[model samples]
Target: MGSHEAKPKVLILGKVDFAHDAWNALTQICDVLNPASTTREDFVKECQSGKFDGVVAAYRTFHSFGITGLIDQELVGAFPPSLRYLASCGAGYDQIDIDACSARNPPLLVSNVPTAVDDATADVNMFLILGALRNFNAGMHSLREGKWRGRPALGHDPQGKTLGILGMGGIGRNLKKKAEAFGMKVIYHNRRQLSEELSGGAQYVTFDELLSTSDVLSLNLPLNNNTRHIIGKPEFAKMKDGVVVVNTARGAVMDEAALVDALDSGKVFSAGLDVFEEEPKIHPGLIGNQNVLLVPHMGTWTIETLIAMEEWAMENVKLAITTGKLKSPVPEQVDLQ
Candidate 1:
């Protein structure tokens, strides 16, 4: 490149907590811009003021929702004509509106960190499964409140029990190995069945069979239009009595209210949830219930995983700026690539 040629501009929509080396390396190649606005409204106004007119690609973090809300139609429309790519620093890109991005005149290709999060997320999923099955939440609470065990109900063992997984993606496949170590049989249902090799000897069952037979059910799918509220009242009725439910996926994927009702009625023996319908604000029923194990969306809270995610997202930004591509483009925008 010649000194006369201007560096391509890239935008950072959130703070880079780690991966400073990667970010600094990116800055050496592309001119990086950070928004001064602290609120979504101000961010919009800043964009409208042409502060980011020349930004060609953007790297966003999930926490950046505070600065700029969902990357929806209105926000996408406010972006400069030069903006063409979005790199999301998380496995789930539910915060972004892929449709709106793709609808732009020269579509905004979006990428997300996928494999980088698999192990960390799957570890959390296994933790939830064990906690829920063992009914550890009640005992933990009891101990914290100065009571020893507090006469908690008997818990079930994972050994010889069937574990039904919904959406057998990377995390789900990783989870199967962990679950199998505990002597649990694994069954899964996905939009499309995986080959035997990818399935890892776990039986591929129909959706109905999965709901009906499993002693424990794990939700591992992404949150999208078709998947929102995928498990609700009717679906709960299909499960075996005394079944345990676990969700490490997005909250909206399972109906929280319906889950409360099921727990109250003893249809579900226990539940393990890492995500909620409205984060940081949980249903009173779940909070009051001793049978539920809850974690505040800390599936990938480890430093190593965070750094990997940040670096993966930066790689997307780097690829977008230098090669006009993304390292791991979101499934919806694969056609655009």
Candidate 2:
């Protein structure tokens, strides 16, 4: 590299809460740019104004959605011609439109932090499973209200129960070992069956078998067009009576209204949810149901996980500027490498 050549520019789409050292180090190699606009409208205008003309890569956080909105066609088109890489600081990239990014002339390659989040997210999934199966939420709420040992229904033990996992990805595989530690028999359904080693003796059942036979159902798949509302009224009707439902994945993956209906009809015994279809605004049905245990999307909320995610995303940015390649390009854009 010639000393006279200008340094490549990198953009920060959201605040770097941790991993300050990595971010600081990145500053030495690339010119870092921060957006002045807070709203989506102003952001688009700012981009069109050439304030980000030389940005070649960007590091974005999940919370940055409030600032830039969806990274759709319009927003992607507004980006400078020099921009080529986008590093998202989370496992799920549903908020981004990969098709739109691919359609661009030079193609905006995207990467996400995957293995960094598996343990934390799986921990939350296990927590929800235990809370829902034991019907602990009602008793906890009752005790909080000064009631003494209110008559909560008897809870089912994880021992000998069938745990049906949808999506045998990293989080699901991690949860399998944790649930097995509680003596639960695990079965899973994925887009395709896993190898014998990866399956770890867990049965790979069909989708229908998973729904109809399991005592507890856990959703851990990514959200996409084919997966939106994948679990709805018709699917719930096939489940065993008094089935426990748990979701730590994207809220929209399962139909919120249908889940409420299933609970109301006594088809589902209880539910534990970390994500909702419309987050920060839960459905009234779920709120009114005493059998439901809810957490506000805290799957990867731990400090350690956040730091790892930030560092992983920064690595992607660093590699993009230095090597012109992403450490973990999204599956959709593997050919872009």
**Candidate 1: which stretches are off by over 4 Å?**
none
Tell me the whole-model lDDT of each prediction, alpha carbons only.
0.95, 0.94
All candidates' TM-scores? Answer: 0.98, 0.98
lDDT of 2 by residue, 153-264 (tens): 8889999999999999889999999999999999999999999999888999999999999999999999999899999999999999999999998999999999999999
User: What is the alpha-carbon lDDT of model 2 when measured against the actual structure?
Assistant: 0.94
What would the per-residue lDDT of candidate 1 be over residues 80-169, giving only the tens digit for each residue?
Answer: 999999999999989899999999999989999988888999999999999999999999999999998997789999999999999999
Total clashes in model 2, counting residue pairs 3 or more apart in sequence or in different chains:
0
lDDT of 1 at 194: 99
**Residue 89 displacement in candidate 1 (angstroms):** 0.2
